[model samples]
Structures are given as structure tokens and as C-alpha cells.
Target: MYFWFLLIVKSVFHHITPVPKIALPTAQGFSFIALTDILYFKADNNEALVYYLKPYDTKTHSAVIFKRLSDIEAALHYNGFLRIRRNYLINTYNIKQVNNRAIVMANDETLYPSRDRGKVVEAYLKEHFYI
Candidate 1:
């Protein structure tokens, strides 16, 4: 009963809340990419790469966004993004598979969570994916 209640509440909350979108700078202008379309964010030296699926495109595409992983995680974490590792911020909805050591994104990219965050990851997976 408790599980079903929580599931229903989550479903309702997800539908009630609008999907978040972030503007990415382009050569012409800026493009707003929906958070749901993103697979993950991999941190580079001083910037991060956003990997996402384009509308009607089967292949995943990437763009370099000028932001720190921590900053991006703070902005999107509440909207279904998780900072599994120090350098990786992943969209929970785009998770293909998760294991004790690593998480596989829809694009077949493998990311490992930090040891300190292992329990948090497990709890999240259990609550969201029943893993």
C-alpha cells in the first residue's frame, strides 16, 4: 500500500510539474534543450559536455556547455538529474542499466558513481527504478 501510494504520488507530481529546459548557446542563437532529452553531462576541465537526443534522431548528439558539473547538478538535480560521480551528472529517465559499480546511459556510455555516494545511488535507484 505504501509503495503504491508513493508511486501514484510521484506520477502525479511528475505530470503536474513542467519539464525543465536549459538554453545552450549556438552559432546563430541559443537553443533550449529539454532536460528529458538529455542522456548525461560529462565534466571537462572547466566546462561540461551535454549529451542528448535530438527530436526524431536515433543517434545521440553532444554539445559543450560552459558550466561546471556542480553548478549544472544544482540546477537540474531537482528535475530528475543525479550527480552519481564527481564528473558525471546523469538524467535518471535516460538510464539504461545500473549496477553496483557503474551506470549505463541510453547512449551506452558507462559511468561509475563515487564510493561515498554509492548508498545514495542505490536508494535512488530503488525508489525510482525499483532496482
Candidate 2:
């Protein structure tokens, strides 16, 4: 069968040929300047950094550019991340604890799930915020 032939070829090539290095030449990794996807840049002098938002790219083997942190918050809110506070957007998958007063993200980071939302954070976490 064609499938068997292809498999044999692949196996032969994989064993005989040196492992071909496949990598995204740095341009594709998460950048602080563009943290939405695969670009990361940070300003050494500035107190507040301007991060770019991108998503992952399968073809490029990198996260794709989405938008800025603010933009991401506006879009993915309650869907992929929990807005623990104005500055911290905790991926619910990263959450380790929750109580009446606060939600704990990894690295011992804790944030009050904005009491104004009442049970919105808890409810959203229950529905979305996957691991």
C-alpha cells in the first residue's frame, strides 16, 4: 500500500538522515512587546512596557499574534482568563485556589476577583478557563 511505502520511507529517512533541526528562528517565540502570540519585547528604560498581542501560528510553529494585553482582556475575558484585578489576568487553568475574598494564581500570586462582579468570576471560571 502507498501508506506502507510512505511509512518505510519515513522510517528510513528518520534513521539514516541526521535529525533535521526545525526551529522558529527567534522571530516566532513569545515577545513581551507582542505577548499575544509569538513575539516578546520589553523596554529596559520604561516602567510600563508596551506588549504586542499575537496568537500562535501552526505553519510557523509559533503562537499567533492576537492583540495587546488590554485588547486580549476585552476579548478573551471570562473565556480563557480571569481578570483577577486591573493588572493581573490569571489563566484559570493556572489557578490554584479560590475563596470568598480572592483567587490564587500560580507562583503564589493572588488577586481579588473584583467584588463588583459578584459571582461573575467564579461562574465564568466554572464554565470556561480550561486547563
lDDT of 1 by residue, 1-131 (tens): 99999999999998989767889998989988988899999999889999999878889888999999998998887888988888888899998887667888888888889998878888898898777
The per-prediction tally of clashing pairs is 0, 25
TM-score for each prediction?
Answer: 0.79, 0.42
lDDT score of residue 111 within candidate 1: 86
For all candidates in order, the CA lDDT equals 0.88, 0.46
TM-score leader: 1
Q: How good is model 2 by TM-score?
A: 0.42
Total clashes for model 2: 25
- Tell me the tens digit of each residue's lDDT in model 2 across 13-128: 98786422112223656433222332121222222122222344233222333334565466555345455544445455556677666765443545575666647776776666
